[model samples]
Structures are given as C-alpha cells and as structure tokens.
Target: MTSMSFADAARICLTAKYATFSGRARRAEYWWFSVVYMIAAVVVAGICLAAGSVLPGILLLLFIVPMLSVSVRRLHDTGRSGWRMLIALIPVAGPILYLVGMTVDSVPATNEYGPSPKAVGQPVG
Candidate 1:
C-alpha cells in the first residue's frame, strides 16, 4: 500500500473526518495532522499575544473535536477501543502510556473498527 501524503492526511483530518470518532486512521494521517495542529496552535498563540485577542482560545475550541476524533480513530487503528483515550485523564504516566498507544503501527488487517486504512491496493493519495 502507498503511504498517505501530508496534504491528504491534513485534508482528511481537518475536513472530511473533522468530528468522526469512528473508523481507522493511518499513522501518517494522525501524525501529519498533529504537526499541522501544533504549528497552527503556535502561530495562533503568537498572534493572540501580539494582538491581545481571543484567537488562541477560538482556535483551540474549533480544533478540539477534530483532534479528539483523530486521536480516537488513531487508537482504533491500533485495534484499541476509542474509549481507551480516557487513560489520558490520569496524571503523568497515563499521558505517556496514551501517547505510546498512539504511536503503535496500524493493524495489518481489520479489527472491529472496519478494514485497515493502509490495506494493500487502496488508493492512498
């Protein structure tokens, strides 16, 4: 299977799957969108600092759902339940474990979430 592109990943996460907490997401899709989210957050913070406005808060509110959805789907891709994300509610160790789970490679085949997102012969672009 061809790996997904950064642009495609970002597009899917920010638009198509914005609030979709079901299904599976490939590593590239999750990580690339995370990078974009971080960069946008930083930029928004800088702008808010300079302008003394509420842009940062607004941006955070806007992206929170999509971020959570993507994270849940990422977990699903690793064959875990979306509810597993509740582990992040704990202190330090919990967040670390949660992150480690997110880093796991996708299941090669299907689990309860449906077909593998990176399955062979799929058009990934």
Candidate 2:
C-alpha cells in the first residue's frame, strides 16, 4: 500500500481534490481523510450539543462534497464504479456491505480508473 501522511491526505481531500471523483485514492489517503473528517464531525456535534445552534450542521454541510468525492475515488481505487456509493441508501445490510466494500484493498495495479495509487512514487493527490 502507498504511504500517505495525514496532513497530505487531508490537504488533498479537503482542497485539491475536494470535488474530484475521477481518480484513485490509496487506502492511507482515504482512511486518513476519514479519520480527520470524523474527528471534526464529533467536535461539531459536541459544539452543537453545547450551543444548541444550527451552525454546526451548516459547517458539516461544507464537508459533504469532499467526503462524497473522496468516497467515489476510494471506490474507484477498488475497481468499483462510483455509482456503487448508492448502495449506502439501502437499509442495515446495505451499510454493512458498503463498509466492507470500502475496506477492500485496492485492486492490483489498475483496472480502469487510473494507475494504482500504490505504485512507487505515485503522489497521493
């Protein structure tokens, strides 16, 4: 797997690739960004609880596009269609299946999306 620093991953997902859904994302890149996203969400939730304000919700809305785009790229890394993200719309089993799919390692080399992010010297973004 390709190694990606948390900062680099966050930078790529939150800025450079904020709405980019056409490329592959390495496991490190995806997970690191996810970690940061979740942390911010938790913090926002806490602020919402403490302040009883809708601003937190609005703040989270800003992340939706980046998160969705990163998720699509992550799926592409696994050689799956970005449309597979719709699977999450299903009930219980759907979320479980979706999580499992995202956890799968990137397909060896590359299928169609592009070259493997794991390829030597491949940049995270």
What stretches of model 1 exceed 4 Å from their correct place? Answer: none
Residue 33 displacement (Å), model 1:
0.7
TM-score of each: 0.92, 0.93
What C-alpha lDDT values do all the predictions have?
Answer: 0.86, 0.88
Please write out the lDDT profile of model 1 over residues 44-87, one tens digit for every residue.
Answer: 88889988988555877777887889999999999999999999
lDDT of each residue in 10-125, candidate 2, tens digit only: 99988899999998987778888889889889989999999999677788888889889989999999999999999998998889989998899999786899998888877557
Error of 2 at 3 (Å): 1.0
Each candidate's clash count? 0, 0
| Model 1 Cα RMSD, 1 decimal | 1.4
RMSD of each: 1.4, 1.4
What's model 2's lDDT at 26?
Answer: 79
